[model samples]
Target: MSTINTSKRTIGVSFDESGRAHVLLWAPDAKQVELLLSGQDKTVSLTRGESGYWSVETRALQPGDLYYFELDGKKQLPDPASLSQPDDVHGASQALDINRFRWTDENWRHFPLKNYIIYEMHIGTFTPEGTFAAAEKKLDYLVDLGITAVEIMPVAQFPGGRNWGYDGVFPFCVQHSYGGAQGLQSFVNASHAKGLAVVLDVVFNHVGPEGNHLQEFGPYFTEKYHTPWGNAINFDDAWCDGVRRFFVENALMWFRDFHIDALRMDAVHAIKDFSPTHILGEIRQEVDLLIQQTGRKHYLIVELDLNDTRFINPVNKAGYGMDAQWIDEFHHALRVTSGQEKTGYYSDFNAVESLAKSYQDAYVYDGAFSEHRKKYFGMKTENPGEQFVVFSQNHDHVGNRMLGERTSQLVSFEMLKLLAGAVLVSPYLPMLFMGEEYGEKNPFQYFVSHIDPELAEAVRKGRKKEFEAFYMDGEAPDPLAEDTFERSKLQWGLIDQEPHKTLLQFYKELIAIRKMQQPLCVLNRREVSVEHNTEARVIVLRRQHKLQDVICLMNFSKEEQSVDVPVYASHWCKLLGSSDLRWNGLQDIPALVPGELALALPPESITLYSNKHE
Candidate 1:
């Protein structure tokens, strides 16, 4: 064995200028490394270099070549950094040439946070075919719906054909069932051509339980800290530098190789790293450097439960300096207020007051004691910082329920319109779940396809116990059932129906209003205020920007209520009303007269008024 440079490409197969593949593996514990070629008995020996890295170069290897690594002359496994897995997670790794695909998005410019209206989608359920190619057909529909960016759920390779994607084992490989790497590249290219940015969701907390081969390659996990999935990923212990580099490189690969504009990190709170510099901070710093080198805008968003401002606070201010984070306070408050089951986390929210606080501040329980957790939670913050991503419904919020019921099933159409107004017109970045704009009746259920029979049985039992607290009506659906996954697929034809079409039109109108009205689009926290009447169950949100002012009045009660306006207006014009007869409402609402303190609000209706003479 000869000592070689450790800084060289010592992970997955990398291609040189001549198109020859350079294969490398990190196996300090193995004394012998052999590359097993597909459909051949011959094996190539790899030389061990410094830092236990084994390296070998050959022209015989090319894109789409299937191969595996044999450790100590036995125990063959897929490459830890495999870029494409044509077979399932248990099959061999296939080399993919990312440069082969020609891209026409070189002139596409990345937009900033102020221009973002994110639409979250799961590719498997977004269309009937459940493939990236199938999803490419919907790009025009999303663009027409006012979505500037599409936040895709995790596409990392998992065990079988169906999964929610959080339980992925191969962080580098795109799911083979979703058209593999080539399909993903085509999808991204199609999106950019249609003027839509792609935001990919990635998980670094813990690897999936099935087909996780990283442990055999290196110490990628540790018992020092435990996560809900299993042992936490090693990020701060001995030889943890490789572990950190692996994940950070994965994020960069999405931006540099896959042409992803942003990454929405899943469950950052579960990533327990007590190092001097957190992994999130390191990822952000590396992404920043990539932005400068490529001259393209990139963003790092996180899904955190801590509600800590440090996630978005600048690093100079002793924070992680993330671009944005998904805040669930607004969702929870809206869910509870709109008459969803309020037994679990909903107990912390009192609806009207909590919604008011959510509009005024990003977090309702910032530094406040929680009865649910029985301890002080969250950091205090004054403004939303335009770094909070607000949504009425998403994958977790809908699929995690006992029955996987959507907000449309849980609340009336009027309440749904009200919730849409609250999220879309807010100062923070707004996101919509798949089919939400059309009021799709199909539920987004929790489904999985695990190969292990024993593990599959255990998953079914665990799901039943988890939803017991909610006291749901029907029996919980078996997660391993194929019918469960099929039922969760979005019904695309629903948009042509009567009520669904009307609701879809209403959503389009609301988005148009948000974009056309300058006061509604301004993200300044100082210009926004919320006032509500507890007894009448009506709330008024005021937004003022220089000479322009807008007010959104919402009635949560079942019966009509008279709301008082404290701020006098010289002239007011009705921009939109959810209960208007145009939107399938029974009553016709008239514009408010000037100097009128008492305004009649229809039951469960939301009305927006623009005061030009304020």
Candidate 2:
């Protein structure tokens, strides 16, 4: 914190008496403007105006200094109120204080997004100095791969050093080449000192085309809503009450100034509010008044593709309370649980009764009747988020595909351990995408770079004619190629190797039986129980409570079938098998005979019994 020497006009930025850095610049058509410091020799003289604001102070500023704004004697700019932009797109503007670190988690907070099992990742491709102290040395491999939370993707200060942080533009700065804001508060204080819990993915719907700067600090944007990542934020236009308090005060400055516990946000259906209490009900009444003023446990989760159930309803039911949303009906029911329906939004998901009503009702076409936006989807989502963050792969569904494959390169290996035993025993919330627990074969494509050559040839001819109905030999990848973000990082030495360490020991024993089965991690759907067969696309859910249960069974079909067993049968044991007949019940268990239970799905296999009538 330095920057000193002054003389009126400091609209906001003043400090002198040997600690220099000052700005009151209001340029009325610059005849002069100077502040340059990079290559220091200290500079700062400005006092023009006939109503074109400009004034100064000097001590030649300090705190990580990187100033600019030369103009009218040849431009140099950046600090259109910058607090940090570190060298992303032509540098300048780096004066951060953020109470100078010194944090230690302070009895940390919020982590249980209904007993999360998340893992998202991407700090400049997770490592190789992707900083946040190189992902705090893999926080004990997500606490031994049992993860409680990690999310992270949009670090809010984007533009080279990496872009999958969804091109941020300083929303209270953090991504200064991945190690800013005291390196993400020392990577969320070393991931809450290793117990986990971080979340973050921000991007309040648009900003990025090289370190934006909120339309030069003001009208922040508004073309009366139009988003596919374009002009939608201005909350309702006209200085939108300070642009809706700059995105709910930058989501309460990441939970009371960066103590962040959860925020996910990014694309609340391109958030275009009409005010009258909306702005996601003023960010759900400012996240319930910052969760009772940081008394702890925070969360806001949104990602929404607009199937909105007023985002987890129940804010005394008036709605938009939001504590969760990303259910895309579990990726349109795991991309049609196997028929390979690859098209924009999986062309209304190929039915297994719409993946058994998106696993027994989470949203299987809430408002129904849609052949892809012809009509319905009038809203639905009764709950889904006991950490309901489901995913068989994420990084925007494998970097928006177009050759980014991976559901272990598009299914198989027993439907990728039957979509990880149906999103880790579904009841909501379960994610893992860093090499989908070691099935890593690579490819997360659709990279971006655009130093505008007509926006990089209109994003490479819109990613080669938008997949002309899924992979039509079009040739894509060249998002200003740095080998397309160095081929989406994360081949972490292929976890122990063989069949990728047997799908990383069946995803570390399905996260150790959902962390030693509290009724198999009860995110509760009345103890979860589902059973169906859409003719062949099998399904089973079970879960249960009071000591034991589990079930799981899934097929998503290719052929091998067999069903019918005294309805939801009983006396079972098997316990995990994606086949090599590998159910480690000390050698796969489907021969029970005592109370009748004989199974074999095989085709795209997945099994996990142990019921005993639950």
Please count the clashing residue pairs in each candidate, in the order shown: 0, 21
RMSD each, Å: 2.7, 21.1
Candidate 1 wrongly placed segments (more than 4 Å): 1-10, 382-385, 468-472
Compute the lDDT for candidate 2: 0.70
How high is each candidate's TM-score?
0.96, 0.35
lDDT of 2 by residue, 560-612 (tens): 77854453444666666776455322234354433544566666777776665
What is the lDDT, from 0 to 100, of the residue 268 in candidate 1? 93
Cα shift from native, residue 497, model 2 (Å): 41
Total clashes for model 1: 0
lDDT score, candidate 1: 0.86
Instruction: Give the candidate number with the greatest TM-score.
Output: 1
